[model samples]
Target: MTESDLIAALEDAGVHVVFLPYPKPGSYWHAHQLIVIDARLSSRWQRCTLAHEAVHAWYGHEGPCAPETEAWVDERAAGLLVTEQAYARAEWLHGPDVHAIADELDVTPWVIEAFQRTLRRVA
Candidate 1:
């Protein structure tokens, strides 16, 4: 979903979302019961960040403190914003370039890179 659609979904789910001048794209501020997204980030990055934080919200908190948790969450977030099947289609159309794939997917290169890593592992 797009950034606005994700925000609306989060709100409808009783999750508070706020955009402010933060350095990072997103953070799940459990103490405040809200998700904070960087207002300065591009819409695509914002959407990806929301997707990431939304997973945390879905689980009611961050996962257990383990090194793999973040990586797992990253993969899930990327897949959430751009489904694996959609990424495959975009990859076919865009070739095997991370920047190009990210551009096509409307996400940051970092997320694309993470998704690519997952693809490599699965292949």
Candidate 2:
């Protein structure tokens, strides 16, 4: 879904989203059902951060997340943001360059990496 769509879905699910100058790109507070995204980030990063934080909220995560939890979140966010068909098309057009593929996919390289990791796990 698009960023606006995701935001609307989160709001519909009782999660409030706000933009502020945060140190991190985004954070999800499960206790408050809130998501705070750093307004200073670029639009693409904001989209990425929103997807990541949304997954945390979807899973009802609380407190600091462990490494495994973070990885799982990234995978889930990547799945939500980037489809396998689109990723394949981008990779075919741009070869193996993460940045180029991400640019084509309209996502961050981190999302591309996470998607790649998910692909590996499935393979």
**TM-score for candidate 2, residues paired by index:** 0.97
lDDT, model 1, position 3: 77
lDDT of 2 by residue, 1-123 (tens): 799999999999999999999999999889899999999998999999999999999899998999999999999999999999999999999999999999999899999999999999999
- lDDT at 112, model 1: 89
Evaluate residue 45 in candidate 2 and report its C-alpha lDDT on the 0 to 100 scale: 95
Superposition error at 40 for model 2 (Å): 0.8
Q: Point to the candidate with the largest lDDT.
A: 2
Error of 2 at 38 (Å): 0.4
